[model samples]
Target: MTVIVRDLRPGTPADIEGFIRVRHRALPYVFFSPASVLHGLSLPRPDAHARKLLAVADGEIIGTAQVGLAEDSREPGQGSLNVYVDPARTGRGAGTLLVRTAEEHLAAHGAVKLFAWVLDEPADRAFAERHGYRPSRSAHFLRLDLACAALPPLQDPPPGVELRTAADFADDPRPLFALDAEAGSDEPGDIATEFTDYAAWVDEYWNHPHLDRELTSVAVADGRPVAFSVAHTHDAGRYRTGMTGTARAHRGRGLAKLVKNDSLHRARAAGYTEAYTGNDADNGPMLAINKWFGYEICATEVRHVRELG
Candidate 1:
């Protein structure tokens, strides 16, 4: 059987569904939906040059790749190409074909350094190393059975701090943006991103298809948002932690834990039965917090990078 690689047609329902299926099977810890996929493709990111590619055999999509530049990073010529092959369809050269196509696309866009996330399994690590990529920091995907796990009981905020939902900021989300930007800058990762464009943030994150403002908890102190736990929900009672952070001045106040716990309790009340979150291996504070919430590490992925000559 001959396997071929091609660009995914955003207008085709089958193409979108097939891509989502392959991705979910390959990385079940993360969330994926038709609306979220389309939303990402529709957004105008000229500098990113983002493209979704698929590997097909017998007209069936067997693998997928998301190729794009890290447009928000301060560094220049950095790109990302993550490839995932359906577990049942591996060993047919689809993975290799997808990687080759993704690299070509990123190179065409002037990428001097390439980064990819590979599963921590031996075979996956070997595949990345064979492609000239070296392993970097690793992250763990944590999952909680929201319906059964004993979540930390919701606690009242300390004096001078009040708990609020992201919906409270619907009229003016700039404060949340400021908090997100500040916290995101300190996040552990290969790419350092800057969120200078509030308009872009509004379009990409605040308006995301899966963002559940009602369940997203925010902690306000000194008349501003000091901590938050962003939430995203999809079909099948699934809930994911998009981000959880505390502002610089708000650190060590237990606000991060307070807001996240509040969000989790609300999510359970709203019928979400499964919760998933990812944490960098080096992020000890966040990891400890998640473990305390009864979340168990279900999967791990290592970031790999390769420099272009």
Candidate 2:
């Protein structure tokens, strides 16, 4: 079989759908839609040089690679490329071709270091290792049966702290951004990211197509957002927590749990039958909180890195 790699034709609706199809088959724990795929390719920063590639065999899409430079990273020459092949169609040379095409594209863009996320499965890990990538931090994907699982009862917020949604701050989301930046920096990961570009954050996150502001819960103290749970849904009965975090000053007060619980309750009530989120394996506190919410680990992935001179 001749597996050839080519740039994704964003102008073509079928190409976008095909890319999403392969991604959904490879990573069912995460939601992918044509809009999300298009946003990723067209909304990235100019310097990011983001490109989406597809591995086609016999006129069918068999694999995909999302390659781009980390323009927002504080570190220089850093790049990221996450490849996914149809689980039912592995070992067809598509994965290798996609990775090679991606690496070449990133290298041409002056990427000095590359990062990829490989499923913790033996075969996936072995493939990354064979490509000179070393394992790093890991994260767990969790899912909750919103239709059957018993969610923790939503509790009333403590006095002086009111609950709101991201939609409530549509006119002024700077406070939410500040809280997100603070909490994101504290998140456990191998690559440290600083969300200093407010404009970029607004475009990439706040205004994202999947973000459901009305479903996102925020905990406010003294009229300021101290914690938030960002929600995303695809109108397909699946809901996901894009992020849930509290400001450093508000930690240890259960604000993170407060917002997340509120969001989950709302999601369940709004006809979403499934919920998903991810946590760094080392984040015991968050992991415990999620367990208390009846979320079970469905899958895991390990971060891998390779150096490029």
Candidate 3:
């Protein structure tokens, strides 16, 4: 059977759903929704040039690729093309076709460096290496059965600290943005990203399609947001941790655990049955926190990078 690669049509609901379905089957670690897919395509950042690529065999989508440039990075000419093939449809040339098409698209737009995330399995890693990509840092996907798992009991806030939801900042999310920028800068990763674009943040994150403000727990101290657990609910009865971090000055205060616990409890109370989150392999503190909450490592992916001329 001939495998064909093409650009995903955002206006076609079935196309979007098919693309997301293949992604979920191949990489069940992260969250994917029709809304988030379209939101990314609608990004105002011209440099992103984000396009969804699909590999089809016999009228069925068997692989998906998110091809784009990281125009926002401080480094120039950096791009990303993450590909995922349905686990049941491997060895059908769909993966290779998707990657080749995505690379051509990114190269046409001036990407001198490319990065991709491959599953930690031997075959996945070998495929990346064969494609000229080298391994880098690794990350883990954790899952918590909110319907049955025993979560850490909710605890009272330490003195001077109060727990609240992101909705509390509906009038003004500037403080949350500041906190996010500060905390996110300290995360472990190969790419050093700085979030100075407040308006963009508001458009992409604060107003995102899946952002659950009511379930997003925040910790405030001295009238400011010190820590937060951003919640994203794309599928019914399922919750994903969009971002969980504490301000620099608020680190080591157990605030991350506090807010995350609160968010998990809120998710459960609101009928969410599953919770998922990702962790950098080197992020011991956060990994420990998630472990304490009964989150188990369900999958791992290694970041891979290739240089282009």
Candidate 4:
């Protein structure tokens, strides 16, 4: 069977649907939708030179790859590509073809180093090793049965703090952006990111198609957002935590747990049957908080990197 790679046609429904189908089958722990996929492609990232490629065999899409530079990283020449093939259609050379095409695209964009996430499974890890990629760090994908899990009971905010929803700041989300920038800088990851552009953040995150403003909880202190739990929901009755963080100054005050719990409770009440989130394997505090909420690690992926000479 001959497999060919081509750029995804954003205007074509079949292409977008195939991309989403392959992604969900390959990485079910995360959320994906036509809107989310299109939104990501529509966002401007000139420096990143982002491109989405699809591997087609016999007129059917068998694999997908998103290739781009790590534009937000403080470091230069960091390339990122994540390729996923339909689980039922492996061994057709689609994965290898997609990787080769993605690497070529990134290299043409002046990427000096390339990073990819491979599932912790033996075959996946071995494939990465064969491609000269070395494992770096791992992260876990957590799932909670919102329909039946014994979630922690909701609690009111402590003194001097008020619980709010992301919608409350809809008119002006600058404060939330400020909070996100401060808290997100501390997230554990190999690629260090600096979220300094407010307009870009607004387009990439604030107006994202999957973000659920009403279900996203925030903790306000001193009349500003100190902590927040960003929620994303799709039509499949699934809810995901895009990010949950607290300002450094408010870390010890239980604000992170407060906002997350609030968000989870509201998400469950809103008919989201499943909740999903991811955490760096080394992030003990967030892991502990998730455990307290009855989330179990369902899957893990190891980050792998390769240097291009």
Candidate 5:
């Protein structure tokens, strides 16, 4: 059977469904849906330079890759290509084909460095190393049973702090954007990102198809968002923690935990069965918070970097 690699057809329902299928199977800890896939393709960032690719074998998509430049990063020439192959269909060269295609596309678009997230398994790491990618940072996928587990009790905010939903900022998300920009800058990662474009943030994140504003909890102080636990839900009873962070000035106050706990409790109350989130392995503070919530480490992925020059 010949394995063929091609650009994903955004207009085709089958293409989106196949891409989501491979992602869900290869990385069950994360949440993905056709709507989210399409939303990503529709992002308006001129620098995004995003492309979704698929590896097909005998008319079936067995692997997928998301290749794009890190347009949001202040640094130049940084690109990302994350590939996932169906576990049942490995060893057929689909993974190799997808990576080669993605690299070629990125290099042609002036990408000087490429980053990928490889599963922590020996074979996955070996494959990355063989492809000239070196390990850098590691991250963990955490999972919690929202239906059966006992979530931390929702607590009243401190005297000056108030708990609100992301919905409250629907009129003007600039404050939330400011909080996101501050907290995201402090997140542990190889590439540093600064969110300066409010319009882009609104289109790419705030209006994302899966984002559940009602279930997203925010911590407000002095009439400004200090911390938040962004939530995303799928029709299939799955809930994901999109982003959980505390503003720089608000760190160490336990607000991150408080908001996340509230988000989780609300998610369960709204009929979500599973909760999922990912954190940098070195992000000890957030990891400890997740552990406190009884979330178990379900999977790990190591970031791999490859120099284009």
Candidate 6:
């Protein structure tokens, strides 16, 4: 059987479904849907040259790859390509072909460093090494049994702080945008991103199909959002934490944990049975907070980097 790699046709429903299927099969801990896949392809950033590729064998998509440049990063020439093949379809050349296609695309876009995430398994790591990629950092995919696990009791915010839903910022989300920008800038990563485009953020994040405004908890201090936990829910009984962060000034106050707990409790009340989230292995504080919520590490992935001359 000949396996060929090509770009995904986003206009086709079959293509979108196939892409989501491969992703779900390869990384079951994360949430994905056709709408989310389409939204990602429709981002308005001029510099965001992203593409999704598929590996097809006899008209069936068995592998998928997401490739894009780190446009928002202050550092230039950094790109990323994450490839996932169906667990049932490994041992074919799909993974290798997808990687080659993604690397060529990133290099053509002027990427000097290419990064990819490989599951922390012997074969996955060996594949990266065979392709000239070296491990840099690791991350964990955590899952919580929302239906069975007891969530922390919701408490009133401290006297000076108030708990609010992301929906409260409907008329003017600029405050939440500012908070996200600041918190995301401080997030640990190989590429540093600066979120300056309000419109792009709205189209890509606020208006995403899976975003759950009612369950997304935000901590308000005085008048501004000091911390937030963004939630996204799928049609299936699954909820995912899009992001949970605290502003730099509020780091030591446990506001991040408070907001995230509020969000998770709301999600459970709303009938979400399973919850998933991921964190950098180096981020001990957030990891500990997730553990407090009874989340266990379901999978681990190592970031692999390759330099292109």
Worst window of 10 by summed lDDT in candidate 6: 40-49
Tell me the whole-model lDDT of each prediction, alpha carbons only.
0.95, 0.91, 0.91, 0.94, 0.92, 0.92
Deviating ranges (above 4 Å) for candidate 3? none
Per-residue lDDT of 1-309 in model 2, one digit per residue for the tens? 899999999899878888989999999999888888778776858898888999999999999998888786778789999999999889999999999999998999899999999999999999999999999999999999998988778899988899999999999889988999998998888776799988889989987889999999999998899999999998889999999898888889999899999999888899999999999999999999999999999999999999997
131-173: candidate 5 lDDT, tens digit per residue: 9999999999999988998888888887799999999999999
Model 3, span 231-269: residue lDDT tens:
999666889998999998888989999999999998999
Q: After superposition, how far is residue 100 of candidate 2 from its true place, in Å?
A: 0.9
Runs in model 1 deviating more than 4 A are none
Greater lDDT among 1 and 5 belongs to 1
- The runs of at least 3 residues in candidate 2 whose Cα sits more than 4 Å from the true structure, single-residue gaps closed, are none
Output the TM-score of candidate 3.
0.97
Where is model 4 poorest over a 10-residue stretch in terms of lDDT? 29-38
List the candidates' TM-scores in order.
0.99, 0.98, 0.97, 0.99, 0.98, 0.98
lDDT, candidate 1, residue 144? 97
Candidate 4 C-alpha error for residue 198, in Å: 0.6
Model 4 gets an lDDT of 0.94
Could you give candidate 6's per-residue lDDT for residues 1-309 as a string of tens digits? 999999889889999999999999999998789888988888875675799999999999999999999888899999999999999999999999999999988888899999999999999999999999999999999999999998888877877999999999999999999999998887788788899989888998899999899999999997999999999999789999989998898889889889998888888888999999999998898899999999999999999999999
For 1-309, candidate 1 gives per-residue lDDT tens digits of 999999989899999999999999999998889999999998889999999999999999999999999999999999999999999999999999999998888898899999999999999999999999999999999999999989877788999999999999999999999999999999999999999999999999999999999999999988999999999999789999999999999899999899999999999999999999999999999999999999999999999999998
Q: On a 0 to 1 TM-score scale, where does candidate 4 land against the true structure?
A: 0.99
TM-score of candidate 2 against the unseen true structure? 0.98
